[model samples]
Target chain A: MRYWLTSAFIFLLVTAFSQEPPSTGFLRHLMDREYYKEVVYLLEQTDYDDASLARKDSINYIKGWSLYSMKALQRSAGVLKSVSRESPYYLPAHFFAAYNHAHLGQYGTAGQTLDSLRLENSNMASLRAFENAGIALLQRDYKAFEDRFNQADTSYYPIKKASDKMLDFARDLESHRKKSPVVAGAMSAIVPGAGKIYAGQTGEGISAFLTAGGLGFVTWENYHKNGWKDVKTLLFGAVFAAFYGGNIYGTVVSVEITENEFQKAYDNKILFNLHIPLRNVFN
Target chain B: MFLTKVSGQPEALHRADSLFKEGAFFEASIAYERTVYLQPESKVVHRARYKKAVAYRHLHRYEDALRELDRLPLFSIADTLKSRILYETAFNHLLLDKPEEALWNFRRLEKTREEPLHSSMIPLKILILNHNRKWEEAKGTLLSLVDSMPLRPHKKQSWKDSIKSLYDEDSLPKNYSEEKAKNLSRFIPGAGHIYTGYPWEGAASFLLNGAAIGFGIHQLWYKYYFTAYITGFGIFYKSYFGGMKRAAHLAEIARHNEMKKFNDKCSAMMMRILK
Candidate 1:
């Protein structure tokens, strides 16, 4: 009779324990193993009120990091922003939040966040300077970037090297030729297709020259043969005038487009350089 | 052990079914997979596998869905259930763009059973045939299916008329012929482009060629034969002939694109019928 009672008790115990909800520790384990999908599922099913303060911070951090890895930048930023200042993970969470902001093209917000980090050591100061330089570069303030970069201590050789490379890149960008639409229009007015050639569009320049010159020649020949009274002469004259005016206008537009294209390409290169230093220093 | 297995199976199935009903296909598939692993030898296992396959399909993981269906033992399931599995297998193949494989499975089902689900297979078969450019067979199959539907004579005649119109559109004659296009431009430098519906290009070609020929003649009259032949006439003639050939090729391509448009429209209509 005692054996039967003990068996019943053990069975009930086993069943009760088996039905218990999954613990936060197991969720952390899944996160540590990089089972992100399972972490997401388990985290959604968990009640945060049951966890301790430290566990709650850990959960939020892991969830934010996982979402960042998944490229859900806005959600990651929101969750990381919730990490309280007293938590041990707060600094790293803030750092990632800055990066997420930068990735979303909010360079000003990213710079301010990095600036707000309390610099307790030389390493922190250097990191702040590096991120500040990145923001300056993205903002196209080369002078400000150089000032921040030169002030950063050179104890970290990688940071020193990255800063030096970026300074040279900024100098190269400053040296690149920039076109003016007004100048291009004036040049084309003097000679057909000259503005396009000045904007580095040689093929288009040649085509414009041929088109304008061909129409002008046809108009002149028609006027010479048929006199001013002929409708054919007037028609050719009007067509030639329209094409000549269009060539000058088109050259101005082409110059603006060329400048815009250069700016886009240069800006992308600067953004790439900015992100590279962050990745190198942080990783 | 047997009792434990029997008791555990329902819990897993119920959880999976709840997840499935909640539109959590990925999690439901995972849960159903776990249930299948727990009771691999039970008859309920087949149902679990089928639902898992369905979950994968909902997730747009057709290859995984087909993999699940492939593991199903057809001999162990009832005929009705087996036919449903076969239909799903064919549907997955169709989604994967493997129309030949889909058609083969669909035909297998047609030979074995005539269920309500099997009725949907006819439109899918027509789609496959049309996609493969087997228009005549698609038409025949469509007409037969329409005839089998319980509709009045006028409604059936309307369906026949729509199918005929689709067939005629698909088989419409090419508006431009390459041979005629090339010959027309050979006689008149820009005529071919105009024939092919490019009047601006025709004008450009005519003006450029006329200027070159006139310049060449004037140069020859002044006894500068080298400039006349080499610089003026030679390049002009080459461009003129090349433009003609290009216009002809473009016309042929345009005709092909029109036929493709018709085919795409028919395919969309057939898909609508399936839905």
Candidate 2:
């Protein structure tokens, strides 16, 4: 079918050239200009019947290119997978296949495809960028992760900035956790209020320690004076015990939350830096 | 003679109508009552009696209105017209806070009327129960009604929000009974684990404490004081902590359960109304 179309075009070209006498270079340019779309349309319309080897190669190449352009990933990957080593597009096919696999969330498959392409094309640095983006997505980095994915590789500054943001959040959270428990415990130990102040719980810590201390002092004084006749001393002791324990528990849990946040941030940074499988597309 | 009675009836009705128009309902009712009595065998007499009931109702003389309404036999009225009258009677009773009477009329009206009376019926029952402060029963009835008639608009209007409000945690005590917790823990230990959110621990403590108590009792009965003391202390410690935790936990659980039940009932009611 393609041969028939080419013959017809050639026949039309000959007649048009005979009548108008346009330059061969301009006509050649027109045919070549439609080269990509025409070939893809022919391959799509064909049912893979017995065709010439050149025609087959042309169809497959155009099919892969068309799919890549349209972002029809799986189809593009399938077409690329069949490209032979002898073909001029064998390297590009491997790269495109890896990208398609990454987009479809098949990270492992994408990594294998990229590794093969890496072996064939030693100078292709862009493959490393794709690998890093894939890694970032897996690690759940919201920031630096999508830096390599902003339509092109214009700058790595966005990735660096994002990484810095993540680092700061992590460091701040870590420092907060480190100080929280120690401050909470020290405040309570010193005078109950001190530990709460350290824990950033000014009002709560002050009230807790003061209330318990006041009750404790009152209970001791009552026990000293009235013997065991009144229940005030025993009641106050119980209240003091509960308040002290609760304050300590609250501080510990608060610090743990801060630490967890930091750990999550750090993990995200590593993932974003290594696009493990590779997935950015330039249209 | 019939014509004479009818002619005289129109004059009495005219007089009653004039008094009714003037808002002199007592006199109007009296005149209508007499007119009906004079023409007792006529349909016009029954119609006049109904009008008198309406006048009495307008004057807030519900008892008098009910009495006049009672004189018109149910069979003497057309179903459509009678349903309207019955609905009015129910509404009047409802306005007077006589829900029991209102409910009766509503039920009767419901049988004849097609527009959401069964749904309307339950709220009156709930209102009556509410008036009596039989809240739990009222809530239960509403829940049952909501569940049974999952999507009746009248039923939704009748009970959903009201039932949910009735089952609110404010209805229960903050410091609920320990016995309830014990029973719950006995079936599923840690069942009452409150403030700490550790029900498994509560259950373990309860079970271990119960076992210790059983061992202590056996040891003490057999004169093994040393063993008894160890087991007894263990039992006491576990039981005390478990009981406290369980009570606090179960209080929260019960509060949540009641709230959930209330919400479920409300949703069911709203679904009925909207559907």
DockQ of each: 0.11, 0.01
lDDT of 1 by residue, A1-283 (tens): 1232223224333343444333333334444445566556655666657545545566677677778767888778777777777656666677777778777878888888888876567876876787677678767788888888876775676576666667777787778777888898898888899999999899999988877776666666656766888775687678778888998999999988888888777667656665565556444
Interface RMSD (Å) of model 2?
44.2
- Model 2 segments more than 4 A misplaced: A1-154, A157-177, A180-183, A201-207, A210-214, A217-229, A265-283, B1-275
| Top-TM-score candidate index | 1
Docking class of 2: incorrect
* Candidate 2 lDDT over residue span B208-256, tens digit each: 7677777678757865454455435545666766576656666666655
lDDT of 1 at A220: 69
User: Which regions of candidate 1 are displaced past 4 Å?
Assistant: A1-53, A66-75, A86-88, A154-161, A227-230, A281-283, B1-16, B19-123, B135-275
Best by DockQ: 1
Clashes of each: 0, 23
User: lDDT tens string, model 1, B92-154?
Assistant: 997897878887887777766755434566776776675456778888887787777777899
Could you give candidate 2's per-residue lDDT for residues A99-162 as a string of tens digits? 5776676767876776565343322444445454444454445353457444234244334444
Instruction: Quote model 2's TM-score.
Output: 0.28
